[model samples]
Target: MKRFFMLAFLVGLIVSGFAFKVIMVTDIGGLGDGSFMDGTWAGIVKAAEEYGLEYEVIQSKEQSDYIPNLSKAAEEADVVFAVGFLMSDAFFKVAQQYPATYFVGIDFSFPEEKNLPNVMTFTFKEQEGSFLTGYLAAGMTRTGKVAILGGIPIPPVQRYVIGFEAGVKAYNQIHKTNIKVKSVYANTFTDPKKGKEFGQALISEGYDIIQQACGGTALGLLEAIKEENQKRANIDNLPEFIDDLYKNGGVFMLGGDIEQEWQAPGHILASAIKRVDVASYLGVVKAYTGEWEPGNVELGIKEKGEGISRMPFTKGLVSNKLLAEIVYIQNLVGIGKIKIPSTEEELKAFWLKGIEIPF
Candidate 1:
């Protein structure tokens, strides 16, 4: 009878051990940003479903709420995820306060001074994916003009622009085409009006393909493209406008961060996908399975953490030959054959290496 009771007690312990709890603390964008926040939440949900873990999220309405929300999540959950680079300071503070709990920071790189053992960070090589998008845009642009829209002048967003410019330069070098690339920063991630205004201005200036790295603000760019397409539908004999529209069924907009091909079917050229969901889900799984460790995890095309999406829409729009070239570039980057520029210094060095810039 004692043996039977001991076995039952051990079973109960095992069951309880499997029931891990996770909590995500979102940045000021909150849950409905339809870009970064939503993508991270999708990973959390996937982890919960796959591991049978309980999960909760605390959405911050403003910058001031970051610390409190992260602290609250750290206290309540076995593993806490502070989503977005904006919460890096708060996450570091909370992780230092609670050394016993595991903390994960998405899109964050920990400073060398604050190297906490219990804290892990996941950062993506967004430039690699953006490079592919720029390559595709250069190939698909009929007007020889492409543009990039950024949410803010942060490093992560800058990486996208830098890589995009490199890809365009590389394409121009190989094809002897003078493709012009323009970039703009909205200074806000949530303002769709600003996105629309900038997008419209670019469209009027004969920029046919616009790639957006802004968060929710990108939705406005898509809306502008749709509205412009409708306005020009009745205007005949406009070969320049017609050629731009014919290249990809309409003015092309490349998506960033998440798989946004579904956001606009034919209008979306491709998405530079940063797999935050994969990172978040894997982080939670590791914590739950006792494999969690402290360090920086940099995911890139090699690790399937970031790449371009080949959704049905993209497959239909992008040619097989171009897709093959994009894949080749992806593999080259993954294998260290192609070095993508991520910083200002590196970009300058790249340009100095006999790469022509169309400006």
Candidate 2:
């Protein structure tokens, strides 16, 4: 009887040790930024609730917090997640230190030189979704001019810009119309003031439609759009371009990351949705199930990794014909019928293909 009790106690200990613990480290934007961090956290929460796994999140307030937070999480958690491209280097260093723990990085493709067997990176084909939004912007614009605001000129942000430009160029070629697109980068993701300044400037320059890849800074841009529209409502005998803007509620804004149509209701035309939550949830599930694969993985529309949102508010606002056209483009890109440019050289080649720039 003594030996039987001792064997049962050892079995209980082994079973308890297999319970999964997950920890996530957010980038500088943190949890409430209503963008990347929020999306990733939602996924972690979902996985924990469904799988009965233990989970925690560390919000990084600055770049310096990355390494320490990752190291701390690595020490305790069965699996640690680094939630943005900014955390790539820090994750790499800490992951090497904890070879026994599984590490996953979102929005990061582990470099060839630093590939670790215990580390896995997930990246999204953001350009494909951005291309769809750009096409929508070109078709929806009454002013023949649209603009894109970027938080930083990083590779991920640049992918959106390049795909957007290509979509606009494709629209011009097909319709034989002169539609102009302007892109500007604010160089920071957390500054709403700069976002508002850039937004107001674009509106003043006669851009009636705007797309943003500026993360939290996009909130300020949305605020500017609301305030500007209210001011324009009181004006008398507005110009043709001004009349167009007034009729459409000042300006239409396109969002990036998660669906942001509810953020400003009528002002938000649509959002280029990157499903970071899905990727994060899958990573935790794989690690918990002992099915974790350590390598670089890229997900696109075909894999249901990225997409564009068509909210209820946009239903009657955007014509069925236009929506159908956008869907057609989306399907083409998803099935490899159309290749969206993600690099500068590819963008240049795509634009020069039988399409002449009028501006």
Candidate 3:
């Protein structure tokens, strides 16, 4: 697909009467998942309009499409983006071949010893944001249980799971109650059918609050939550909104990377937001001004890159006291006073350290 947007004249722009060409290669999830990939694209479009650049998006149908698509995009792209961690291998290979083009990889990380002169990378501190959601889930869960649905067991998705468990463990320590978090992986980020099955099964097993880091596969998770909400609404003759639904009897899901209430309205609690849009937009702006440089940017709560959504549709479900506590923990996290675990090994240690609540 092609999109051309015109930016108002910026005298400071060194465009020299030319527009930068940008290309975005999506993972198997493509777009419209109301998740991270979509968040990345939104940034691309915003940058294109701001700089009056021509942009094209190519959706990869499978993993095999990665190398060829990135190669093709690099052929004419002044700046190109490879979205998703799954594409990092293909991205590194193709970026090496095209030294003239600036390449951006979303959710890609390189070892400290390595550097690619023409490539820049963006990695989010997903564990930090997921910690907030996990805390919320623990405080709000009616069944004393929550869950995590991971698309794959990659580092990026693992961070979401481990951090969530840390938050639950923290809450358990503070309240002297055991709230369990069950994590499962589908091993695929694009399979909606499997995602739905996992979501429904978790709910059946009495997990009332679930957090999903499954990309497009999460579309199915939302569907299951919507169905559950509708069933409970009808059975209880509930109101239009999910106000106090947790206190009632409906299940809920938290999304990752973007605000996803549009996917399931009141059934979606909130999303652990990662500011991919900001990163993508800034990448374009820097490229336009000759400020583009190859480097790694790791964004977390301190950088305004990790957090949770505003809960536009389900505001009433989260109590004000719970919201206040979330903020308290968020500030502690932002200031580095609280360190969240992002790996299985770290999670184990975190439990032993215990959550020390000064209050």
Candidate 4:
């Protein structure tokens, strides 16, 4: 009996020694919304496969779940990732308690963390991508007006909006063109009905294109567009104008945070994608390897970490001249040819002064 006990103990020790455990805590949005959470999970899986590490994920039911899920993961795993900006407060609290365990906060910024070496924060300049997409929308609109539909007027969403406006203003200044935008926030992250209503209102106002930064709410906006398209079935070149006030007035949809090109093949011009997978995976790898540093890592078009992706569906739809112009604008932002605004104050200041990047 003594000999058998000793052998069992040895086996357990060896197994524990080799186990490289990691845990991921996702936001209330869940894993597979074809959005941010899914992108983060993709990176987690990649790291697990590449580094021979084991990972477990806890899906958050709401904001309240952030602390508990993170605490639970910290108890067992080598490192934990608190995904989403919504999890920032919870992550800070949990990290303070478990000073030894590593934490990575995606889109969560903390300049002062009580010197918590275990917590690392990551953010991206989504405005950069948003600006590029906004420029595209301006150039594509046959009419001088475009509309933006957003999930919520949160900081992140606001960043995209500010960037979009700045981009449009800069493009006009550069090319000496006349283009303007009408922006609205749906104010809810997942309300489809409101989204459709907002889209309808924009169409009624003679807006020719829309940039959708909303999540599930964007689905309704797209549905509204589809319904409008159906009514113009027999029309030539898809009716330049339709009688229905809710109909898409030659509107094009641009999505953010996910590649929504397939959601509407020809209608969705492009997508502004946040590479959450890469961010999450890097966090895991850092924690496991003992190189995890606590600080903010900001990504943008310059970093190739986030940007607007040209869709396969519209590969040939946008004219070559238009495509070249869009690319030029993107490259300008990427290489500092055009300095886009990041904050509300900066955006206001830039436009007020009519300042243009000399690039």
Best by TM-score: 3
Model 2 TM-score (2 dp): 0.89
What is the clash count for each candidate, in the order shown? 0, 0, 0, 0
List TM-scores for all candidates, in order.
0.88, 0.89, 0.91, 0.85
Most accurate candidate by lDDT: 3
| Residue 278 displacement (Å), model 4 | 1.8
Cα RMSD (angstroms) for every candidate in the order listed: 4.9, 5.1, 5.2, 4.8
* Cand. 3 TM to true fold: 0.91
Q: After superposition, how far is residue 244 of candidate 1 from its true place, in Å?
A: 11
Error at 45, model 2, angstroms: 1.1
Candidate 1 per-residue C-alpha lDDT over 259-311 given as tens digits, one digit per residue, 9 for 90 to 100: 88777665677888999998898889888888977899999888998788876
Residue lDDT tens for model 4, 1-359 = 99999999999999888798889898776665566777788888899889989888999987888888999999998889888777888888899899888888887688573557787777888788788778777877778998788776777778888888876877686678989888898877666788889888887787867888777677778877766665654344422323221243456678777677877665677787777777888888888887877877877878887788866666555667767776776776688756778787988876524444343
Cα displacement (angstroms), candidate 3, residue 320, comes to: 1.9
TM-score of 4: 0.85
For model 3, residues 223-296, the per-residue Cα lDDT tens digits are: 88878877777544334446446557689899898887777677788888889998898777777778887888
- Report the candidate with higher lDDT, 2 versus 3: 3
Off by over 4 Å in 3: 1-17, 112-114, 235-239, 244-247, 351-359
Score residue 19 of candidate 3 by CA lDDT: 57
Q: How are the candidates ranked when ordered by TM-score, highest leading?
A: 3, 2, 1, 4
Better-scoring candidate (lDDT), 3 or 4: 3
Candidate 4 regions off by >4 Å? 1-13, 234-249, 351-359
Q: Candidate 2 local accuracy as lDDT?
A: 0.83
At residue 246, give the lDDT of candidate 4: 26
Candidate 1: misplaced stretches above 4 Å? 1-19, 233-249, 351-359
